[model samples]
Target chain A: MSGIVIIGAGQAAGQAAASLRQEGFEGTITILGDEDSAPYQRPPLSKQYLSGEVGVDRLLVRPEKFYVDKNIDLKTGTRVGSIAPSEKSVTTTGGDRFEYDKLLIATGSRPRILNITGSDLEGIHYLRTMGDVDGIRESMGSASRICIVGGGYIGLEVAAVARTSGLDVTVLEMEDRILQRVTTPEMSAYYHQLHAGRGVNIMTNTTVSGFQGNGSVSAVLCGDEIIEADLVIVGIGIIPNVELAETAGLKCENGIVVDDHCRSSDPDIYAAGDCTNHPNPLLNRRLRLESVPNAMEQARVASANMLGGDRVYAAIPWFWSDQYELKLQMVGFSSDGDSSVIRGDKSTNEFAVFYLNDGKVVAVDAVNSPREFMVCKQLYGKAVNAPDLANPEFELKSLLN
Target chain B: MPQVKFIEFNGTEHVVDASKGESIMVAATNNLVPGIDADCGGECSCATCHVLIDADWQARLGARSEQEESMLDLNPDRTDESRLSCQIPMTDELDGITVRLPEFQY
Candidate 1:
């Protein structure tokens, strides 16, 4: 049976396969992944995995034996070269063609490369895959200093790991402050102080002109000033892997354009995860989220729809980051809110920042405050009293009732 | 290795062997037992790995950490026996531990 073929083995691809089986789709399921390893979780690649807290076995979303027992044909190290929509088939770079009754594109995303001089230096790296982290870990053993470009979550996370490993860490951000894109000035300042207090050299409003080294990267050149570094990690951002969809006559915007059902232009073809710019009914807008929750939930929705079930993907986007002892849990888009209220003492390092828009809660950034973060997930678009929200003594659960 | 008994919401039970120091959530996910999402990969950040410890084994499991308690308190389905399975590591004393998966994670 030419049943289902899923491309790109990631959270979405693995989840789609599992959900399909759970939905009792008694058909052939094949997952094609370009990476040699089976479907693994990438979230920990920057934190626990890089810190040696977790091993490769723990990174796997499911055990290797799972695919075997579930009768799934998982093809690893197979890169798809092209897709023929009319024929409903995909050809790999190795010239193998596979036909599918239903095609799921979970191509995910890749790190946006900084194409400046010395970009191809050996010590320069980006943390998007397992192989990349392995390279970084190898370099960290001999290296004493690490310069991370971009002050986003990945950069800050890497910096935390680097500092904890006893390496000199410097974070270079082109923006006025770190985490400028996703968080507010106050939050950015908090993280900046947090990193600085941890002995990390954080440089804001700093731009890296290029890298300077003999063979490997020895320094990051910022105009005339040179920041000495044995290794450099660029976490600028990620670009959606939408070239395959674009070439196949599918709608392509910043990402592969798909409806709420995760269906691309083609009726039989579906897309999920970072690759698809799907619509979120909760947010009332189309967004491409590089989040595990979004990926897994979209996979479930797409899988159910593939099996003739109508499941809408309408989940509030939430994400978390681990930096030392702090666990930052965020829900919804903070940008959607007009004003934000601090729920607890930031000095204690246990507080929740509630972002409200017109008296309705829009988002929340909870640091070491999972109780408030969990309640905030359910408080989206609901009107909340400013005084009650700001009072730490008042339980957030009461607002729900 | 200690044995973990995972009961699904629908009453299907699957017992799997778990190594010492491995969390109950890991044992379930590794054994291909459905229900435990553990989306954060045992970070204790995501409460998707919520499970109810068998009443007989509750006292032996010890109290939940402050973080786990806060996370569990947010769950509407959480009872007194509720615990994030990722926080419970397997040990020789915890052999034959029985836990039930909630009907829904979110």
Candidate 2:
């Protein structure tokens, strides 16, 4: 009996159910989604949706008819409260309980809120869901000034959109540069120029002291000054939705700790997505990836393992970001790298930066350069024999077809 | 433009048009092929555009690069028949090609 119950119906949860069926698992499958809508695409929220290129219906992950055709029970508008590991069941906040032979916790993550005054203001928004985007888009029209907290991908993307929409955009980041935590120093500097050239004021090493308005966030308070703002968007980071797993007595570290197979400490239970931290062979560390590809891959692998398939969750880490016609694609973990080399002209908006750890190619960040990005995927475990940044003779096809 | 037949796991037939110089990945993306994600814009950074060339016409396609050959190892259900659609540049000689997407891509 499959009797598989998946919680938090995002990409991972939805994919796990589909994968389980695809793997020939004949067991009953149930999906619980907190959002009222069916599984929808999230990446487009900041790009097409935020830019008003698409509508809510277009963001749907799949057609409603497909769920019925798959013989899967998708329960929307449902919030799974707590899990009972001993009983192998999940109790919903609305008092409904589901018993399962196997459980996959894909609760994912929530936007980390700014913990200062005026955070509770009316015009401020944290874009993690469709509901959040709807609110922000509706309020954006009348907004004269938009103050964004954090200069990460989400914040910068919103800043670009706000600036394009004719709003005075100011980004306050506590870090030295935008995307400093994830990308290289050089990459950060490049984006700094790109955003500033677009008329977005990026204030680094600055923290929000408080809010200036009486109730509805008219201005944001910085060190010794206040910047007028009619709208605020906080995109600091994300906190893993690990409270349910923790309350259920699962092994919890920075995220819910899972083995290579994506199975939690509770043998029958599995965890995927941002909520689960698994051993990364490439990184050689147990870390959580807040990326869609990682979440989707791990969920598929977990499904395979649950169905008696001898599949181990093994793949190099990769992530991507889209901002202002620039597509940045990254592969492998580059945090441990000591040196990096540029392969093309980033000024022309086409380049790949290869990260090397002791002469071994560990990671590559490609900005609008798909050819080198393809080569970097092939050269992941290869040694960095040629570390020259401007080597035109380095044929990417020969390196990686 | 040439028409190629794409056979799905459940035997659904999708006849798609292929441009002369565009890679199969680009053609599939143009036709909105279900499984070929081509996430990295077909740069090969992401192996999501993987497909197994039809056994009958496998030899018709050029030999995979050492890089493409190595990248094939990263694919989940990799077989000797496997090829990344991005690497196989489309041509008139490659018309009537049929490729099988891995079962996992859906």
Candidate 3:
């Protein structure tokens, strides 16, 4: 019997396979992935790759040689259709059968496309996979004006890239401000300023009716404003790829439902990464994190559990986004808080905002301030009595120490 | 070019020629130091390339920017001496400096 079998070839699956071996699971390890390419970092694909600062090769999480060295049977371009809990096996899309002692479902999420009119128009792309980036990157060359449907990280990141390349970029968001759902209004104002300063027309509280063109996206019609565009990148968000799990009779809510040990309703089957909706201790709620840190960490925790080792996957959700020269680093959920203190000048786009819930620091958003972000991730749930974080003499290092 | 003493990880220190314009991470990566994994490629995105600045050299390198501070905060078990090697650019006074990497990049 195969010692361990992990479905989905993304970071969580890749890490789980490797960790199982590292933890001394010598039996057959099979990692099934839908994508042909090896597991690569998705965060960089939107930033450095979009900016042309890093090459494609550097995006890979690990080289092909590492898999060979680790003796991991890295099965690329393979998709697992469903899992038979009673038989202790998985059936792939190609009808190949694989039996396993332990199963890990790391089937990651995919971009949620708008189901509206003109959604099928050409030149309208969703930024999710490697192929999507290639499509957007290629179109960016000739596209004079680009309309990004969502004001999320991916859309803003692509906007930065397009603006840098001298393409007129316009971001359309239905919300009152960009990142309204994810970050504080202070953060929204800061990022909004930075993007607008870069000549990115951020149109918030405005909805895109749909695309306008015969076969291709020529303009995005929102209200009365018909903005002409050569290309449209939709980065609204991602819906967990829970179809496989749901079909397999796994309990799924917003995402693939998993317990603390990352075990699906089936004891033998486990899930991790962006696809799984696990309970977050930090937020005291069930939260689905779509970040690399969460994916990689959960993979490690889940892999240990699969090996019969007791390990709980509890890590603060952390993510970073690079737009132009600004690095936005966030740790924990700062959605709705009692107050927030700005640590530096927002105009210069270099500062950290401490998100306080009733007096305790619940989360932090660091704009171009990574070290403070690093410290605050450790200080989560701590009673930080800071009257004013913007006090010039107040150092984040002391709070950490 | 200024000669700075980089403990070649051999326990014995060796002096390598570094230009003033380059960052310490750039100098170390360029000189083929095994420890520094400058994954962000000197952009200070990932905190992989972490190092401890020599106490005496701390005053000369100036203070860590708020951006650098936030990045370092994400670093596990960081120190006052902990500095993202990418942020510390080599300068005229940064000679004879030494840095040590943590046992495990945990």
Candidate 4:
């Protein structure tokens, strides 16, 4: 057999390679990464790595030796220019062609850059790859005033780190509140206060009209005011890398559309992680989750199906975020109509917000309450009363019973 | 690099040269030590990286945080020595630390 080939060595590609080895597929495996280093975890980049609490070595999903030991070919700093589905082959930027019996697309997502004037300024940056963070870290030392664009998880995380590092951090979100696209108003309000209390100047309903600088960014023109910034970090959002999949004649929506089996439109090709929009059978919907757990889980399922396993990927999706001393662990997807119940005291930084729809526990967002998060994971997709969950006296573990 | 020892559920020991300040979960996963799943990349949200520290090294490992305590409470194999390996950094004091992976983790 020609063996398996994985494109884009992010978390999904890394997990797919590791899973193939674990599943005892000993033929041959190859991972092509455009980054200079091996596949590393991105979660820590905004937190530990950015704050210098951890080094670059700690960010690795697995050490360089793991690939060599598993006899997996890892091509770093290489990009696949195009894919020929007819020949079952892909050509790299350097004109190297490789054929595969099974192909996995995990090209992942890129940070959505701003289209405003002075966006190309040297000081304006986006955090995505190892190199991106490395550049940000270097700039942070000399930057006393930092203006962060967007009020999402990435922006909030960077604000938390910047505040701790004694830098003047200002966050500008076009929306009325931060994380408006992802979380509930209660959760958004909680974080808004959290960052505000920590001395981060958060400006919501604020949009950066343009960047004002000489060669590097010095100020952000928002509304009628110019917010002076020594450095700027844009964390608006990400767009999935689907150009290759589109060029290959595979199905591409906002992301590569995959079935329950994580198989793409092409039988020989499979897609997983951030790049793939797969069905969430549990939610009865299709979601493209840009999370570590989702990426890893989908990759596992994709790898299994590639090895001829008839398993359907129906696991509940969970996500977590760390901001300062608070850790938010969320399970299941919470939609707008889902009525929510607060389970614990929010002031103490230990609380769990349970979102219910039609008397069924649809999702939960737990902060500092790991036990509640764990129970919520077990109770995922099950019907439960909001009053019972809201009642503090009622034991969460009893729901499982 | 500090040498950290990881013993599997079946008593297979793997000694890894862990870099200073990196978590034990990173050390294990980087070195291909099978037992530490660390599904959330050491966010302390996932209990998959749970390990039982040896009595000799318990004091040097520091006190468990409230979040770690709550996470350990959910695990069926919770013990006095059980810890989320991601929370334990590889410092010089933990150079010779030995931990046993729970059977459930494997």
Evaluation by lDDT, superior candidate among 2 and 4: 4
TM-score of each: 0.97, 0.84, 0.84, 0.91
The residue-by-residue lDDT of candidate 1 on A1-401, one tens digit each, is: 69999999998999899889978898999999999988999999999999999899888988888899888899999999999999999999999999999999999999999999998888999999999999999999999999999999999999999999999999999999999999999999999999999999999889999999988999999998799999999999999999999999999998999998999999999999999998999889999899998898889899999998888988999999999989999999889999989988999999999999999999999999998888988788899898998997887777765
Note the DockQ of each predicted structure: 0.60, 0.12, 0.23, 0.47
Where does model 4 sit among the CAPRI classes? Answer: acceptable
Residue-level lDDT tens digits of model 3 in A214-325: 8888999997889999999998989899998898899999888998889899999999999999987657789787877778778888988988889987777777888888
Please state the Cα-based DockQ of model 1 relative to the true two-chain complex.
Answer: 0.60
Clashing pairs in 4: none
User: What is the Å distance of residue A313 in model 2 from its true position?
Assistant: 1.1
Winning candidate number (lDDT): 1
Residue A219 of model 2: what lDDT?
88
TM-score of chain B of each: 0.96, 0.90, 0.85, 0.95
Candidate with best DockQ:
1
TM-score of chain B of 4: 0.95
- Identify the CAPRI category of the predicted complex in candidate 3: incorrect
Model 3 residue A87 CA deviation in Å: 0.7
The clash count for each model shown is 0, 4, 19, 0
lDDT of 2 by residue, B8-96 (tens): 66676678877686688766655545577654444454677888875678888888876567556545467888998988877888888
Off by over 4 Å in 3: B1-43, B46-106
Ranking by lDDT: 1, 4, 2, 3
